[model samples]
Target: MDVKLPEGLEAFLAAAGWGDAVIEPLAGDASFRRYFRLRLGEQSAMLMDAPPPTEDPAPFLRAAKWLDANGLRAPRILAEDAPRGLVLLEDFGEVRVREYLDQWPADEAEVYRAAIDALVELRRLPPGPFLDYSLAEYQREAKLFVDWYCSARGLDVDAASYSAAWEEVLSPMLPRQRPGVVVLRDYHAENIMLLGSLGDQGLLDFQDALVGHPAYDLVSLLQDARRDVAPELEAQMLDYYLSKTGAGADFTADYARLGAQRNAKIVGIFVRLWKRDGKPRYLDYIPRVWALLERDLAHPALAPVARWFDANVPAGLREAGGGSWQP
Candidate 1:
């Protein structure tokens, strides 16, 4: 029954004349950000409490402005308390693309197509000065698997070997990054809302946007760790996005390679969430990540990384996170 806000958040809302609004806590994602739905009669807005030192709201503010300017539905910013890391934002309603798909499974294609179109629109934005999501940076991410996951299992996988394998796998693909492609690092259903007149996607959690490979966001959608997008539909969506786009014909290989790298990093991240952050919810997603990793590794371009995993990672380790991952 304690609906009271914390860390001056209640005072912040009260100052905004929303002290009487009914605030309902919303389920948060894997990040440290917290959210609440503030309702004042029929009018409503979203409250983002990203208390700093642990979380920052500046990037969210910047990305939202740029995305909105570019015509993507990034939620209009209503108000902000920067020092406190609180912001009131335009609510994109309650229907997420994921929830919509659950309600009308028949509209799967239409829903996903809208999301793709939003991505196509966003791909045109001139990227900001965020950190480059470079191969070297990702190689460090892959080392998380060696540092935490392998260590947890009491295996001594050489970090140098792991980084070397990533290098071999990514060497052919790194320089191929599509210039100006502002990859919204997390573009999956959970963060995308189904809304607006064009029925297109509304984006969320893109404060970490970075300049990177074009296929990165697309792979994020199709190879979602949160939900299973049927393989056939995944292929269709991929084909749909590529048909009219100017990406090279061999972009499919690039997509698969990025997918492999992303998934590899995610598996390690999920493991770290368990071991370091003490958040075990992500542990359930590891098998799903492994399945995507398997699919990505299937690509000929991922041979070195695939071979590395096959040789260094034991069968028991592969099966540690229990879930059914099929081809």
Candidate 2:
């Protein structure tokens, strides 16, 4: 109710002939950024309020432009105040993949297939000048879990052992990987929108687009936050991706490694979200993520890391904040 607009934002809207518009705050995630839906006549727009010193709209704008140029479905930027970290964008509506999936469970396969298709198409585009979403970056992100969540649960993680095992499992994977065009780091159900019947879903929150493996986005999608996509479906989708990309026989091992790596990182991320960010709703999903990690670890290719987790990591760590693990 007390949504704060940037300085001179009202004036800017007034001069742009949108003075009569009504703005309402929209639910936001953990980021410092805030969003508002603006209604003008029958048309609507979305405004991003990213306060400066902590949030910047430049990277998002640049990534959006690059995606648009590369034939992706990112929102078109209508206006901006980069210095103030504010951006006005075309509204993509409220039909997230989560909502659509809930409404039409019978269409899960078709809808998820469409999402996979979009990911493949996005991966086909040439890489842009975003940022390196490298193994080091992933390692850094994964460590956040131990620092926050593990510590919160009163678990003392052997940092050296964990890092050594992680590197032992993931290091060899880097060279074997065929670099892809670009990966939308969080290309999941929540970030994708069912725009309409245009056969195109809206891509949102892709500011972290990076140059990475083609399998990365697929892992993010099937291994999502809101729901537990079945392992069978996950395998089928991985095979579908492999076939479409012509990735050859070597891809199977690499895909499994990537899946394990992604699941591990997400487990840590979900923990950090609950422990540090005070978003405990994510805690209930940790067990499912850990189960996915365990399944991925079953691949013979991940023996070293799997052994470390199974041996050193306490069972209490997995059941730290349990809700349901079978999903």
Candidate 3:
């Protein structure tokens, strides 16, 4: 289905004297928003079309400013029409971390290290109201995986049991965290660009950045949904981060717990993308995530939730299969 451009988009471009540019549709996410790559002579820009009622572009604009101010590489907002929910941004090119790694696996460690470095730098930024990375918010977002995926699967999960187990694992872990800093909620391969000369990786789709756990972003990048980062590499990266931060010995255990939590939440999110958004492509990433979740469960840190899932989530539901439930 073709997406209708918001009213006055043509005028906006014309007023900016970009009317001669060629606009082509780019890939989009599950949200109602759409992206178009516009070419004007030697210059290029990304056009965001986020229809109102279902999508708003304010968060993206606000986050762009915040990231730019804090020494990150979010897209620069070239123009905006908030009432029409349209914005034009500088194009970051098409060299996502995933593509770069696929072409040059040898550079994975270096690329990932740079990505982590950017994340660490982001963590140094002071807190702000625009960034809400509190524990309650994290728990709420994590529960989305359960609500959308588990419920859709018709699994009989005892909410109180699940909640209690989550608290048992996460509550103590929370206070052990050092001072809060900005966290790119989805700092994965897909959202990073490997610009050749650009010292820092280009950050994209960070409208949901928050002030929370220092390890959360690291977990997201290393335990990515699309790529298979080796165990040795993952361990080395974790250690590298620890050395940089000078976190305590318990940091390893906390990292494992956070990884397990993040993987489980992603599993539900992938399933939800398929079941709710009619985007079944996300289902392909489920097995890898499940493996990560199970691996994290093996860690002594996640014993409670691991035990609960092993007993409750049913053996058949552990893997992806065809068939939809009426419920």
Top lDDT prediction, candidate number: 1
TM-score of decoy 1: 0.92
Off by over 4 Å in 1: 1-4, 196-198, 319-327
What TM-score would each prediction reach against the true structure?
0.92, 0.92, 0.92
Q: 1-327, model 3: which lDDT tens digit per residue?
A: 565565788998987778899888877886778998899999999898987878888887888888888778888888888778889988889988888789889888888778778866766677644654556765776686678777777677776777678778887777765467677778898889766653557888877766677788888898887899888999999888877778787777877888887887887787788787888888777778888887788888888887888777776766543223332
Ten-residue segment with the worst summed lDDT in candidate 3?
Answer: 318-327
Local accuracy of candidate 1 as per-residue lDDT tens digits, 1-327: 334465887788888888899989987777788899989999999999888889999999988987787777899998899889999999888888787778789988888888888777766666655667787787887787777667766776667777887888777776777465778889998889867533666888999888887788999999998888999999999989987577786789989888888887787787788878878888888888888888888888888887888887787757654333221
Candidate 2 global TM-score: 0.92
Show where candidate 2 strays beyond 4 Å. Answer: 176-178, 319-327
Task: State the local distance difference test value for candidate 2.
Answer: 0.76
Q: Write the per-residue lDDT of candidate 2 for residues 1-327, one digit (tens) a residue.
A: 447677778876776667789988987786888899999989999989887888988889999998888888899988888888888898999888888888888778878888888877876776788666677876776666566555655666677777777777777767644455677878888899888842578898888778877777887898775687987888788878877778767667766777777777777777677656767777677777777777778888888877776675677655553233221
Clashes of 3: 0
Off by over 4 Å in 3: 1-3, 319-327
